[model samples]
Target: MAFDYDLFVIGGGSGGVRAARLTAQDGHKVALAEESRMGGTCVIRGCVPKKLMVYASEYKESAELAQSYGWDFDLGPFDWPKFQQHLESELGRLENAYETNAEKAGVTIYKSRAVLKDAHTIELADGQTFTSKHILVAVGGHPNVPGLENADLGMVSDDVFTMREMPKKLMIVGGGYIGCEFAGIFNGLGTEVSMFIRKAQILRGFDDEARGHVADCMKMRGVTIHTGCSPTEMEKRNGRIWVKGSSGHEEEFDAVLWATGRNPSTKGLGLEEVGVRLDRGGAIEVDDHFQTAVPSIYALGDCIGRVELTPVAIREAVAFHKTVFGGEPTKMDYDLIPSATFTQPEMGTVGMTEEQAEERGPTLVYATAFRPMQMAFAGGEERVLFKMLVDKETRKVLGVTIVGPHAAEMIQMAAVAVKMGATKEDFDATVALHPTMAEEMVTMKEPVRTLD
Candidate 1:
């Protein structure tokens, strides 16, 4: 059967781009279609831009810390427009890089929206259709804003990049990492920030103790955290958004940002019409190999609702290419995947949480919390928590969580240990570096408590 291409990707996200590039590099015909920018969410709107903003927000504290170190200077107001301009420029550069890489790999680039016409046929917005031997969907996901009065009046995480000015008083809804992160960001940038969470704490589904520490740190930083509550209504008047809280309190703010959650972007793609199985969350249902029920079609990344991380998606793409094109079967390993939340204090986590470990079997918990030397000497009240969950029977480190500065960097190394199935003895046997927060991970020899 003759086809227009050997592989046709319906997205230009990390997963799709990697797949297209790898397939083409493997001497196969590949074409990738993306209606929007090439880098997809992580590069264009999500992680990259968000981390830049996090860095920008941290400068306020950076300046304050410098003052404590005998530096004298009054920082000026944050230049949001200037930062935004620079951010957009950088995004443009990245988008161009994605396109360039794809073109260099001999993959055709279609700057158009694509839909499934059948298991192997993709129809573009321009009324052009192309057939491929196999199809891959990696369109990614979008922010899920619930239906509410004047909901459009609020902004999502993606819209933060487009904001022309910083809000004086910002109301962030939801208590997830996205919401908590922006709370820290806006608060650090000198905004009177308030967060409304339906749950009692932010960063739900994470280690309870670690999440509690993060929420406490956020509160100490002057973020007005409203737990056990949410916004019921939003109204606009006098250029301010009036939010009616579930507690029957109404307040107005310069802007409202919704970081509630994300839904798989499988809308209007005609997946069902073509016999692609979709999960209840609208994510494409695929097997361990990422092959959809329709063997000719496949999906991965956030669109499949499986470990929606940029690196994970890229790995999945690599494995998919190795399996289909290179004739080597491969499966993605989801265990011990390290993740970082860019909040004020930051959080790095990998493997199971304490609760998750306890549920599996007998677990020994090694936990420590103390103010870091730098912050302590500088007369700061901030603290860091380091915890390790180990299997008592096997002595294997089941999970590791750190909440404090440089946690993201520390977790990367910790993840290696967890992935290698390093036991508690291995950590204790290692020599500790002097005057460092990371040394705590190795120095904690005895279990604070054991769970059977």
Candidate 2:
């Protein structure tokens, strides 16, 4: 069979672009089609822009903290238009980079949506057809907006970056990382942020103590959190969004955001029609090697529902290339992958949760919560938490959870030790760096409680 290319990638996301570029660089003819921006979700709409906003939102408090430290300055109001202009420019630069890199690697770039017409054939949005020896799908996912009355009146996470004007009062629904992070972002930006969470606490499935600490910090920061609540309906009324909650409470806000969740972006890709099996959540199902049921096709990243982080997606792409193109048979390691939530008081975690470790065997838990030197010196009530979970028998550190400013930064280093299977005694043997919040990780001498 004559094939137009050796490989055809159906997405231009982090995973798809990497796969296409690598395969092309390996001297195989490859082509990639993207319906929208080349940088996909992470660069165009997700982490890059969101982290920039997080940084932008923190200046207000940073200025106040500076004043407490005897520095004098006045923090001006947030200028949304100016910030957004820069953000758009940065994203455009990133998209161009992705495209240029792929082209340099000798991959054909198509600015159109591509869908499967058969096991080895793709049909583009312009009715163009191409056949390939192999196909890779990395379409990623889309934010889910629940089916509620006038739900279209609410915006999703993707809509946040291009918002014309910052809302004076913002109502956010959902208890996941997205909802909590945005609550902090808007509240820090001077918006009256209110959160409606159905769960008892935000960040479900995370370390309980850490999540509780985050919720407390959010409350102290002036974000109103309504736990045990979810929106049942929403409508526009008098130039505002009126939301009715499942708990029968009603409220009005200038803007409402539905951060419920995201679903794999596999629609109209003609996946199942070509014998690609999809999970119940519409995520493409793949085996250990990221190979679909059909041998000629493969899938990875968010569309496969395996670790939906951008870095993880890139790793999967590398693994896919090694396995399929390089003959290395590599697989992405999902263990001990640290993650962070960029809230006002951030959270960083790696390895097992206390509950998961306890379920496996006896465990030892070491924890501390206190105001750090900087915050204490500034007379701020904010406290930082450091917790380590250890196996009672092996004495190995099972998990590490941190909640405070720069928790994300601290967790990255901690994850290295955890990934190496460092024991609690190894941590105790390391000398503590004095007067540092992270020193607590090494300084804790006793387990607060032992789980049997």
Candidate 3:
């Protein structure tokens, strides 16, 4: 069954949606195959819903912050059901928006699972096979459940957002970004959160100082963090799950969330049947331009298993479309990307960390941590930390990270400097924004320390 189209995309998540719609906009006949909902993991499960919970959790923080602003009133107990209803309604609105937008863009969408019967051809779940000149597997990633005793008792990131009722206690099983973010959401909503991680620290690959500050802030906010620990067994005891770990520690909780990590979402896609190469992590082996071993097939997003953020997926999808269809093509510059953790004291970073920059040569680390000016009267003791990595040789700013109010917003501006390959002198040359937390980027006076 050959279809007349220039491109076909599978998995209508962030990457899939953009690839299909944008390619269609370029006057290429494009078809998208999605097994479930059209909107990808980011819209339905990952980023959108999680951020909403973050915003919902912040209202509680706001009341506490209100005390310092000379406003006093009795805050009502949070209604979990009310929030769940609102979240569901908002999700409905988003689904409608996605459908309307795709239709307007003239993309043919197939609401069925797609698998490769042969290279350059996909079989729909409903017994339809469509062949295209180009096939993109943007299927994204899913929870990586570990194999441990009572591992079946642990819930993944997907289960956390769909929780209808509140828990007496939640013992989250992973200490990575997903687990840490959920820990913050649970703690902020007044649930006791205990975390277990295999490494000495949470967010193991992130900048050490920023990670340490976040771990401390989370601890202060009442999240019991357990490092260098792995749960060995689990059992149901007294209406709770009893978790016995190798650390010789035990805890009981209403439920367990295993935000341990995620792997590429290419399950049952039949890649092996068509000779597409897979990396160690089951990620589609793609070349520099995101082309798989078979050039007719392309893959991006979590399916490629690196830089699994939504924006990165979008960039990959956009670039893939442009390279194949657009007259001029641009390869993705993996560097200069910025991301933030929605956890307490919300951390944001762009470019090299102090540790990363040191591999080049001697590097200067400019760091400052203090109470936010707005927090001085807010009664809450929340603080912001800013760190920048610069080459002592060139004084060019390599990266910037902020862990405080609106850290994400701050790092976005800093990313421009990083993308332009700005040095330390570039940061020094720019005038400060004044009285805003963002000004900290241009206001560092001393090297907190130099790293080699």
Candidate 4:
């Protein structure tokens, strides 16, 4: 049967937009529908805005560092409104770029939500229906606010960008990267930030030593972290929000943020009715090639519950295009994927943690923690950590974890080495760049302890 378009993509997120644009560029008719902004979460409200805020928040310390370095200046109070205005303008520019690129690639753009009506049919929010040869769903996820009494009084990550003013006292819930990163951001921005984490440590899935270093740094930076705690209820009282924790501790704050987690934005997409299977967490079930249970329908990115990063989504989109249209089947590589948490000090990691590597085989761990030259010279107690995990038998570097200034930047290069299966000897053979925090990665000649 003839179709209205060769492909219909149900989202305008990084993944969806890339897939739609690539397919259209291949000379196939492609159409994309987005319920909200063009750049989806990452460009619209997630990483882009968050990173900008992180930069904005760091100026207070930057000024102090400058003063310690013999530069004279007074750091003024953070102007939220001015920064937010610029942020909004930047986001608008990015959204326009996404739309312009898609249109230039000859993809039809629809500013409405699209849902599946059948294996090959999609219906827009306006009740307009269209049939396609293939359908791709890349709707991303949203911050999850736990269901509790007066939970609506609390804001999620998405609500942070829209806040008219920064809260004087902020109570953040959850221990994941979102919670920790925002804790650092708000605290740096001069908010009295308090974190209620259900886990023993802030970053549960990260390396134990690295997370410990981060938690210590966050506490030293004036973030009151209450580990082994979670909010059981929230209520508005006397112009403030009061939260009762699972540990029976109660606190009041000017604002409450629930960064517990995120759920895939899959509701009302009509996937179940169209014979597409969904996982227990409401994520769409897709095969290795990103093809859904129904052959004509495919889903990727956060909605599929895989690696929920923007780069991963774009890679999946490229892989999908190559597999379905380019006649070269490709699968996304999930190994050696580097990630970072933008807390006060920051952390960047690629490959297995000491715990994970030990579980696989005998491991050798090399680690160092010391105040860097800049921080030490400024009379600051902040320390940087560099750790490398190696396989005892194979001598291959199993993982690299860094916690300190530009950890994210350092990890990108470390990821390249790890991806190439560089061994500990290869790292050792590289000459150390003197007086640099990164030099420690190459200079750790002895294992702190070998785990058999």
Which residue runs of candidate 1 sit more than 4 Å off their true CA positions?
A: none
TM-score for candidate 3: 0.97
TM-score of predicted structure 1: 0.99
Residue-level lDDT tens digits of model 4 in 349-440: 99999899889989999999999999999999999999999999999999999999999999999999999999999999999999899999
lDDT of each: 0.94, 0.94, 0.85, 0.94
Give the Å error, residue 227, model 4: 1.2
> For model 3, how many clashes?
7
C-alpha RMSD of each candidate structure in angstroms: 0.9, 0.8, 1.5, 0.7
Q: 198-313 in candidate 2: lDDT tens per residue?
A: 98899999999899999999999999999899998788899999998888889999999999999999988899998999999999999999999999999999999989999999
**Per-model TM-score on C-alpha atoms:** 0.99, 0.99, 0.97, 0.99
- Which pairs, if any, clash in model 4? none
Show pairs that collide, candidate 1.
Answer: none
Query: For candidate 2, what is the TM-score?
Result: 0.99
Q: What lDDT score is found at residue 74 in candidate 2?
A: 75
lDDT of 3 by residue, 261-357 (tens): 8888876889977989998889999887888888789999989988989999988888887788885677887877899999887999998877788
